[model samples]
Target: MTAITAPMAHRTRLRLTARGRRLLTAVAALPAAIALAFAVVSGGAALATIDDGAPAQSFATVTVSAGDTLWSIAEDIAPTADPRDVVDAIVRLNALDGAQISAGQSLAIPAEYAP
Candidate 1:
């Protein structure tokens, strides 16, 4: 009797419609889900730190004037950072490819990129 009722219910059910809405929602949530999963997998095991209400850091923004070289900019941003290391940090910070940079741009000055 159960088998007969199950088959009848399956056959009588109307096919649910509308794939576009569901697909749109899934696509929108993909990036957030990926970020959450990455954070959880990467840092979930970390232990607690002592609570401190210190003011958050305010990062400085340096504008690139005309004819400003990357080396000069990097040096100014990271004075103590090694030149080679600063170059790598600049590339990563400015999101550059092949040491490319244009004038009249702005970039964040990272304190350090540890070895």
Candidate 2:
């Protein structure tokens, strides 16, 4: 013969009050707030020191004239160096968008190619 069992009682759902919900939100946000604070504090120092009085290297500036191109300018400035290499150096040093340069615009030549 099998024994009879009693039915289980229903449990009520846990309801959070306003204060409890605010405390829960604060707890969840605590770590993120602390991380942001640490980042702001620790990032406020100089990672490396460099002497600001004297520059390590200086660049020579060239003024682009009418009818002048990078190839011609590079040839004129650095006669001993290859015009293509000089042009490439000038483009990179001046942060040019392309080989296109306008008249009267100033460009910085790399020290190696500077006259």
Candidate 3:
């Protein structure tokens, strides 16, 4: 008589509970959260850096006239320099909104063009 044998084809699937899934997700996100926090904390250090090596710039004051524009002022102040460069310097020095300047507005000219 031959003995009958069962075929070994049984497979088991691994399943995680809701709490286990949440714990796994938290573990996965912890490193990314830590990295973001570290970046934010480290970036704050750059904001307060003071450059003591550079000397404070000196500026010459000029009052705007009724028809004076940045281009015209730039040309009048620095005839030897490029008007665009002079205009950009003037705008940056005065923190102007644009090329617009009202009458009687005092503007600070860069020291390079001071005369």
lDDT of each: 0.64, 0.83, 0.85
RMSD of each: 12.3, 9.8, 10.1
lDDT of 2 at 49: 20
Per TM-score, the best of the predicted structures is 3
- Which is better, 1 or 3, measured by lDDT? 3
Q: Alpha-carbon error at 97 in model 3, in Å?
A: 1.5
Position 54, candidate 2: lDDT? 20
- Residue 96, candidate 1: how far off, in angstroms? 0.7
Better of 2 and 3 by TM-score: 3
Rank by lDDT (best first):
3, 2, 1
Q: Write the per-residue lDDT of candidate 1 for residues 1-115, one digit (tens) a residue.
A: 3554434544566564579678878999999998788768867333211243212342345777888777877676666877677777666755677565668787655545322
- Model 1 stretches with alpha carbons more than 4 Å out: 1-41, 44-59, 113-115
Q: Give the TM-score of candidate 1.
A: 0.45
Candidate 2 — which residues are off by over 4 angstroms? 1-56
Backbone N/Cα/C clashes per model: 0, 0, 0
Instruction: Give the per-residue lDDT of model 2 (tens digit) for 1-115.
Output: 9999999999999999999999999999999898778767877333222234223465778899999999999999999988999998888777788999999999887777777
Model 2 vs truth, CA RMSD: 9.8
